[model samples]
Target: MKIAVIGTGYVGLVSGTCFSEFGHTVTCVDKDAGKIERLHQGIMPIYEPGLDVMVERNTEAGRLFFTTDLKEAMEGAEAVFIAVGTPSRRGDGHADLQYVFAAVEELADYISDYTVIVTKSTVPVGTGAEIIKRLEGKLDEHLYSVASNPEFLREGAAIEDFMRPDRVVVGIDSDRAKAVMSELYRPLFLNETPVVFTNRETSELIKYAANAFLATKISFINEMADMCEKVGADVQQVSKGIGLDNRIGGKFLHAGPGFGGSCFPKDTRAIVHSADDYEVPMKIIRSVIEVNEERKLAMADKVIKACGGSVEGKRIAVLGLTFKPNTDDMRESPSLDIIPALQKAGAEIHAFDPKGMEEAKHMLEDVSFHDEPYSTMEDADATVIITEWNQFRALDFGRMKDLMKSPVLVDLRNIYGKADMTSNGFDYTGIGR
Candidate 1:
């Protein structure tokens, strides 16, 4: 199969590369000539665990290519995926569809034959219908078929999610479109991967609904962690007890600062705004949003209280700045809120992450960033674990104690136990411990 993926951002780049790994010829189109040049030089714009190697292998095999010209990439392509950004609008919280629509308009002019125009971007429901309407006078009806094929890739584990996804959801209004999409994903058929075939609206809504539900899980567990702290119970055992239930298998149940990333925050807000447009209310999702925002802000106070009721004139060491480990995305990270609030309260911030420091430098101001973890903790009053990166899991406790002015630890992700820290001769605070 020949595929052209528009917009070589995270979704488009990973999806296009993986499609090539599936033995399909894929051309990833981006308007940025600099990004395309970087791809040609084997330089990736974003970091994923194994993306660079896969892209290099596929390019060497003549299965993948990158170009800035849509017409050149779309030449003889059977499917063109619109995998552009659909970020949240500034004031309305609705999905900013200008990029998606612009991609559609650009690719519509190059459709010379029967082609499957699939929306691989996370978009609101009814977007597929709008694409069809947008193409009414631009092309012949038989020249193209609009379908919805939303992506469900996680940031750190995108390649694994794409190749071994739990299931694949595709929306089609015609058999011709379904056949093309099925052929495109024929490799997955060997593993008997379940593929959900539904209408366009349902397929689009599935992406948002899945993200919103996961956000709800995070918010629910954070609330449980708060109550556990008040009642002097352990939230980890509480999570384990409920997770053992067959119906409520545990994922995203760990208590943390809050949920922050590209997908959860933006998708939840976009869905809520979409529901409101239809006069439908998403009360639970709205609460989840509110809870997540409040949780990020409250973490600052938690750190302040951990430092003897005041962080004024103190140098606080923070480990982890990205939303989660294995990715260098600093969008809406809890550290963005926590560090700034601490600075406002007259504390000097020192932070370190395995990969997020370079990006974090742009987002955070007046914070001392170190290359390594222990250096950030040097002479600090207290250490706070915001993102649970693997390196922070097993730290040199003796070194941390030696370097810190006072041995105080606030384990927000519950990666360290209260008893262990206390035994190590340090004051420790964990979420709902």
Candidate 2:
């Protein structure tokens, strides 16, 4: 298979690289000349575990290439994936589809043969039909087909998810499109990975629904954590009790600062907007969005309360900045809300993350960055674990106590036990217990 993936953002880069690793020839195209140049020089625009090594090996094997020339990349390609970002619109919360539509319009001019155009970005339902309508007079009807193949990769574990997906959901209106897509995923077929075939609208809805549902789970557990705090019960035990059931199997049930990053926030908003457009109200999803926003903002109060009802003139140490670890993405991170609120409450912030400090420097204001976790704790009034990066799991309690002005620890992710922190002679507060 010869494939061209447009807009070399996270999904485009990862999909193109992984496709090449599946023994397909892939060329990733981006409009940004600097980004293309960086890719050629073996530099990645974003961080993902194991992605750089995979890109290197595939490029060395002559299976993957990157370029800024879209026409050149599309030449002789059997499939073109439009994996551009679909961020939420400013006011209406609808998916801003200008990028995806523009790519399709530009791509329509360069198709020379029968090609399958797949939407690998998470898009709203009926987007494929809109694309087909856009290309109606611009190109011959028989020359190309548009399909929806939404990505479901997690940020920190994208490569593993791409290679070993739970299932591949593809939506197509024609036999020709289905065949091309099937052949493109033949390797997965050989591995007996289930490839779900459905209509384009259904496929698009699947992505949004899955994300919104997962967001609901986070909100549910967070609400449970709040209830547990009031009732003098441990949310961890509550989560375990419910998660033991096969039907409610544990995933995204961890009580934390709420869901953030690229997918959940934007997708949930887009879906809620889409439902509104159809004159249908998605009340539960709407509540999920409301709860998550409130949760992020409330974390600052959690820290403030732990610091004796005021953070005035206090230096608080924050352990994580990225929404979740293993990626440097700072979009909608809980730290974005918590840190700024803490600063507003007169708390000077010291923060550290293994990979996110560089990006966080741009997003965060007036916060001192540290070289290591222990350095972040130096002379701080209280320490808060915002993201559960691997390194923060096991810490030298004695050293942490020695570094801090006051021995106060707030574990937002519930990474530590109450008994352990109490035994260590520190004032400890966790999410639910």
Candidate 3:
């Protein structure tokens, strides 16, 4: 299959490259000339594990192509995927559809043959209809069918998720479009990844529902974590107890500072807003949003209290900065809250991450960046672990103690056992324990 993935953002790039790895010839389009140039030079704009190697191999094999030409890229493409972003609109919480619409307009003008125009971005229900309406006039109506095939790729593990998805949701009514989509994902079908065939509206709803459910789990655990703090009970134990039940499995139940990334925050808010417009307010989801926001701020207070009360003149070494490990994405991360609050409390902050430093530098201001963990902890009064990177676990505790002015560790991620740290002559704190 010759595929054109428009908009070389996270979704587009990953989708295009992975499609090439799927034995399809793929062309990735981006309006940004500089980004295109960098791609041509084998330079990646974003950090994702195992992506660079695959992109390099595919590009060298001429299976993957990157360009700024929209019409030229779409020329003979059997399927064109609109993987553009639908970020939250200003003030309203509705997904801003400007980018997706703009891509559709250009794609409509360029289709020379039968093409399945798939929406791989997370979008609101009825967006497929809106797209068909907008493109039907200029588009070759007989040759193109609008399909919603929402992507469920997580940032840090996107390549793995894309290559081995649990399910593929295809939204369409036309048998022709369904057949083509099935063929496009035939390899996955062979591998037992179910192709969930459904209508466009239902598929869109699934994306929102999946994200909202995941957000609910995180928020639920976060609230429980707070209660555990009040009653001197460990939320980790509580989660383990409930997780043992088959009804409530143990995924996404780990309590953390808060949930933040490219997807959950925006998707949850947009779903809530969608429910609101229909006069069906999701009260539980609304509380999830509020509780998540407050949780971020509360983590700052947790850090303050962990350091023997006052943050004044304290040097805090933050051990991790990314939302989660294995990627450089710093968007909406809990570190966003923990850092600023620490700074406002008159604490000098030093931070280090294996991969997130470049991105985090712009997001977090007035913070000193260190080359290594031991280096970051040098002379710092306390250490706080924000993201659970592999290197942060099983670290040299004795070396950490030697470097830090005070041997206090606030492990927000629960990476280390309290007993181990206590016996090692350090004060260690975790979310619930």
Candidate 4:
């Protein structure tokens, strides 16, 4: 199948590459000439694990292409996937669908044959109907069909998620659209991957609902972590206790600073805004958003308290900058809030992350970036773990103590045990324990 994926962001780039790996000819289109040039030179715009190698292999095999021209990419394409960003609007919290609509308008002008237009971006409900309405006169019913095919890829594990998705949800009313989509995903179908076929609104809502629910779980556990802290209980034990139950799986049950990334924060806000637009109240999700915001700032307070009720003029070493590990994405990271709050309290920030330093440099201010973990902790008053990278799982406590001016450790992800830190001659403060 020939595919044209619009907007070569994370979703578009990964999806196009994976589709090409599945033996489909995919051309990823973007307006940024520099980004397209970078891809042509084998430079990746975003840092995703193993994405560069896969892109190189697919490009070498002539199955993948990148271009700045949408018309050229859309020519003779069986499916055009609108994988542009639907970021939350600046004040309203509603999903800004300007990019999606613009792509559809331009696509209508170029597509010459029967094309399956798929919304691969995470959008609010009724977006598919809006797409159809946008192309009402520009394209006839026989010329194109709109479908919702929301992506469920995680940041660090996007490649794996795309290649071996748990299930694929597609929204389509037309049998023709379904046939085209099925052919596009024939490999997954053959692998017995569950392909959910539903109407467009349901498909759109599925993405928002899934993200919102996961955000709720994270918020719920975080609130539980607070309660456990007050009641002198262990959150990890509580998480494990409930997670063992088949009803409450252990995926998003880990207590942490908060949930912060591209998807959760933006999608939750967008869904809440959508609910408001329809005059429907979503109190739980609204509370989730509020709690998550509070939690991020609260993490900063945890670090300050660990530093003897003050961080004034203190040098604090932070172990991670990215929202999560294994990717260079700093969008809405807990470090964004925590570090700034610490700085506001007169603490000098020193931070290290395996992949996010470059990106963090632009987003953060007055913070020193380090080449390694120990270097970040050099002569620091306290060491805080914001993101749980693999290397931080088993650090040499003796070396860490020797490097730091004070032996204070705040483990927000609960990666280190209380007994272990206390045994190692350090003042350890962890979430809910």
For model 2, what is the alpha-carbon lDDT of residue 382? 99
Residues 101-148 of candidate 3: C-alpha lDDT, one tens digit per residue: 999987787887899989998999889999888976697688889899
Ranking by lDDT: 2, 4, 1, 3
Clashing residue pairs in candidate 2 are: none
lDDT of candidates 1 onward, in order: 0.94, 0.95, 0.91, 0.94
Q: Judged by lDDT relative to the true structure, which candidate is superior, 3 or 4?
A: 4
How much does each candidate deviate from the true structure in C-alpha RMSD?
Answer: 0.7, 0.7, 1.2, 0.8
Comparing candidate 1 with candidate 2, which one achieves the higher lDDT? 2
The Cα RMSD in angstroms, rounded to one decimal, for candidate 4 relative to the true structure is 0.8
Identify the runs in model 4 with alpha carbons over 4 angstroms from their true place.
none
Clash pairs detected, candidate 4: none
The residue pairs that clash in candidate 3, if any, are none
Q: What is the lDDT for 421 in model 3?
A: 92
Candidate 2 yields a Cα-based lDDT of 0.95
Better of 3 and 4 by TM-score: 4
Cα lDDT tens digits, model 4, 170-264, are 99989999999999999999999999999999999999999999999999999999999999999999999999999989999999999988999
Q: How accurate is candidate 3 locally (lDDT)?
A: 0.91
lDDT tens per residue, model 2, 3-63? 9999889999999999999999999999999999999889999999999999999999999
